[model samples]
Every structure is written in C-alpha cells, then in structure tokens.
Target: MKKYVRGLAIVGVLTLAVAACGSKPAENTAGGDANKDFKACMVSDSGGFDDKSFNQTSYEGFQAAVKAKGLTPVKAESKSDNDYPTNMTAMVAAKCNVIVAVGFKLEDATDKAAKANPSIKFAIVDSAPATPIENVKPLSFNTAQASFQAGYLAAGMSKSGKVGTFGGLKIPPVTIFMDGFAEGVRYYNKQKSKNVQVLGWDDAKQAGLFAGGFEDKAKGQNTAQNLITQGADIIFPVAGPSGLGGLQAAKASNGKVNAIWVDTDGCVSAAEYCSVLISSVKKGMDVAVQDAITSVVDNKFDNKQFIGTLENGGTSLAPFHEFDSKVPAELKTELDTIKADLIAGKITLESKAQPKAS
Candidate 1:
C-alpha cells in the first residue's frame, strides 16, 4: 500500500518452495542457493503485456519482484478466454513457486489451478474467488473512489456539458469504474445545479455500454465515436487495449474532444494520445503484484485479499499532464476538496461494484 521500495529486498533472502516438475534450478545472487530454485511466474489476460493497462502494470510488479529476489522469471500470455486454463497449466508444469493471474476473467481458471495444485501459491488481479482457496490470494482495488474523482473532473471540464464512459465487459471490475464515473458527474450536477449528462452508463439501472471484451480497439473506437456524436466532449473507456480506440476517436476530433484513461497513466503509457487525455484513474497493481510475489518468496504467503483504496496508495488519479495549463485553478482546488471529503467519508460513492472495504 505504501508503494514498493527497496525494503522488499528484505524478503529476497528466503526460499520459495515448489515441488512441481518441469523446472530446473537456476543460479541467483540475491537469495543464495535456496532461492536459486525459486521461480515466480505470471499469466496474462488476453490484453497481453503491451496493453498499456492493468496487464502491463501487473507484469511490471511481477518482474520487479523476480528481479529483486533473483528468482527465475516466467510468463504465459493468453490469446483468448480459451487460453486461460492452458496457460495456467503451463505455469504449473514449469514448477512456478508462485503464479499471478491478471484480470477478473482469469478468476475461474486461477481458482481451479490453485485448488488442483495446492502447493503452488497463486494471486489473481482484479478478482477474488467465490470460495476461499488456501493457496490463492486476491489482489483487488476500490477503483470507484478514484473514478468518482475522474467523473467529477470530466463533468467540470466538459464544454458540451456531456461526458461518456464504456467498459470492456459487464463484470464488477469494469462496471465499478463506470459506476463511480457516472456518480461523480451526478455529484457535480448536484453541487453546481448543472445538467451535465453521462451518456454511456446509468449507475442506477446497473446497465450501460460495453465493448464485450478488452481486446478490440475497433469496437472501442466505434463506441467512443458514438458518444462523441451524442455531444460527449470527454470520454472514459475502461476497456484495456480496446480503450485505446477511445483515444483514437478523441484525437480524430481534433481540438473538440478530450478523454480520460484508466489502469495506468496514459501520458506515460500511451504518449501518442496525450494531447486528448485529461488524466487517468490509476490502480497500484504493480505494487500489489510485487507484494504478492515478495510474500511468496518470504514463505509468508496467505490467501488474504489485498484491497487497494484511496486511503491506501492502491488507487488514484494521475497528474493532469498536458492539461495542467488548461484546467482552471478553481476547479483544481475543488477537486482537492472533493478528494479530501471522499477520504474523510464526507462523500460516499453509490457503486455496488466496489470491493468490500478491508
């Protein structure tokens, strides 16, 4: 929660146990002979590592932990839903001491893998299993809190008085963002007596637009263009790689449209679209992934759920970047107040998709 630091190296000296086959020990410097056999692996969702989103952020953490501990690093990238089980099985066959499965779609496969292979530690990003598995830990986030701020920000900045958002799927993880974003706009309307509209999601109805999945940029672009046609000046896309299409749409609008990114800072991860980005809703998936790996290496692994919140450093809004000069000073001050109020519980979000507070 405090963010990953060199202090994690303290756990590097311990050895992780993995009795599975298909793995040969590799030499390492940090953890000595015991750690030489320790192998940390990851399984990506269909979005892959270059999605400039959660999958990429999660892998960064996994690699950081492996690098710090001098453990063997391995990964399996899924090409589609059907690949989940097969990729996870490959990690098991590779004798991975710990395997981190990225994205909520991997929940079933991760749950099955952990139960079938009780000895291997597992962590799943963005989701937790229906029933607790002793070998699996859940890495989740209360992204709604940060997205609430993004919603408010979009509302305050919209020139057309309309904002829009769409998700990659209809799952809790994705809807959670739309819920918060919609509510944020509603909050702004209440405070300013302005009729700022949210086009793609209706939090009360628990329904809105979705790209069906996270991999198709064409669908995302089409969805964003639709919102733009409806006069939405600011768009939010919660669909990993597909979300890039929203940026593409915004860019094509010239100076008329702008957007907000999710998962990672768009300015840093998708610089080509920075001109149209207002900001990003960020999750500390990298830190969570690294912490999970560190726990495994220290032999202190548990199935406890790791819930990231605004109170923790687990979720936040990225800096305004190029929009810094354009956002009004009063609006920035108002955002600060809103953030403080949210943290103090003076403001409450209405999203049913938010993860249970830890």
Candidate 2:
C-alpha cells in the first residue's frame, strides 16, 4: 500500500473568517427607473461585488435586469459580515421593491430583515435556512454534480496521479464542491484501477484543507502550493476570490500544475487565469438572479426555492478550453456518459452537504 501522508488545514490557522454583520454602504443606480421606479437592490457578502465569483455573477444578473426591464438598480457592497444586515436594513428602509442577499453569510441577516419588512421581496444566494419566510427565496445549487465531472477530468489528465481540492471555508456551500470532487477522483480510481490520489479532502470523514476565509489571496496561494508540494498537479479551489490565488499558483508553476475553478468559468470570470484553469464547476446564479428579477417584474414573486441542478441547466462543467486536446477522447465520452447516468437517476451521489430538497 502506498503510504498516505495526511495534513489537514483546518479552521483557525489564520484569521477567523466569521461573518460579523455593518460597514459603509456601496450603492449603484443604473439609470432612472423606466418601470415606474420598480427598485431592485442587492447586498453583497464580504467578497464584495468584484470577487469575480458568486458576488460578481449575482450582481451581473442584477445589472442585466436593470437594463432589460428598465428597473432602478440599488446595491450595497459589504466588506465584512457586519455589513450584511446594515446593508439589508438600509435597502429595506428605502423600501426597495426587491432585495437580493449575495451569499450564505447574509442568510441570517436576510431572514430577520425579510420578516421585519414583509412587504419587500427577498432573495438569498447559496443558502436556504430551515425556516422559510414567505417573502425570502433561496437561490441554491447542487454544484457537486458538476464538480464530480471536473474531478474526473483532473484524474484522467493528471500525470502525477494526484489531484487536490480545498475551500475558503468548511461550510456546506463550499464543502459540497469538495465532496463531489474527492468522490469523483475515487470513482475514477475505481473505474480505471489506478492509484490516483486526492490530496486535500477525505469525503467519508468530511475533513480537509480550508483556508478559513475567501478574501485572502495569499492563503489560497499557500494552500495550492501545499497541495502541489504534496504531488498534486491539479488543484480545485472551492473558495471564491481566494480561488484566484490558487489560479495564480498554478499559472506560476510553469506547466507544473493546472487548476479547476468554481462558481463561474475562470476562463471568462477570471480570464487572466485561463491558461492554468482546466475547467470550472459553474453554478447558474446569473440565470437564477435574472429569473428572480423577471418574476418580480411579472409581479409573481414567490418564496419558492430555486434549486440549480445539472438537469435544470443550473450547474455544469465548463468546456475544456486550453485543455481540449489534452483530455483523451475516451475520457470525454466517459464524462458524457456519467452526466447522462447522473441525470437519468442511474447514479446517485451521497452528500450531506447538498441543499436539502424541501
């Protein structure tokens, strides 16, 4: 048996990435309202609007709605957890038509504000708190499905026979991607009878490397370097902005390593890192946010949960851009077959980290 040298980067190794909820309000108004001042406001997580991941995509969708429906746009950018409630309350005090919270960090704040301001429609990205307030809708995804494919691709392409994954935090939203990634590597090992190793995470134990927060690029870079030093040639970062650091690590490796991105295609979202990105496990937050705005425009805002799964085109593996020729034809065919199997219910992934089907 090949010896497994395990080293876990757990929480608290660096600054505690707790979501402390008030900060200055950053607002955006994209032209005056053409829809009778149908105001739409959004509150970003600590990742800010330029995180180049979830927050960016969510805001982009909101911006798209502002242009498409001629709606008044309002936005508040949070620098920390403190800013979440502060931003939401300000938007509520303004009595905006709809307020979107950009991440799971804002779920608690969003819940309190939504209940207090029942007249306002609320949307939360990446979190569905157990208590369902009629006014707040959750925009979530089973991103694990897509991540599994990325893991398989990494395993198939790795000459080192070692791939790695890590997250900004240990939260379910981030861990779901890691869980699927590790499992996919295991599945690939089984199918190919190869000794491919996933360095960062252990699915059964639900323990692995975490940078403790998403905002620190240095931490992400170090985490990727750690995995690479341990023989990982492919790194999948489930962190938002921190993922950019991992991309930097990979790019600096001079062909020594490649990376898989999360939330949105790094090829486009973080185009600077495309050369190092193998692919991305994308969640359709842009599409979901746009749909939410459309629903409001149609005056049919319900608190129903919007679950993004592969079957719904809400989550998917991106095209193997620079790696198109590098991936074996057989491997690509296998991925398609696996995708079909997953959608057809012939295969099921077991993960407590996925969104609860309510």
Candidate with maximal TM-score: 2
Number of colliding residue pairs in model 1: 0
Tens-digit per-residue lDDT, 35-116, candidate 1? 5678788777778777888788887788778777777676666667776777777677768799888877777777788899
Candidate 1: list runs displaced more than 4 Å: 1-34
* Candidate 1 local distance difference test against the native: 0.82
Quote each prediction's TM-score.
0.90, 0.91
lDDT of 1 at 120: 94
Tens digits of per-residue lDDT, candidate 2, 1-358, equal 1111101110110111222333333344444456746877777777777788878888778877778887767666667666666666767765578888777777778889888888888887787768677988788888889988888889998999999988998888888899889878888999999989999899899999998888999999999899999999999998888878889999999999999998888899998888888789998988888889778888988888888999999999999899888878999999999899889988788877778655
Error of 1 at 239 (Å): 0.5
As a TM-score, model 2 comes out at 0.91
Give per-model CA RMSD: 5.8, 7.0
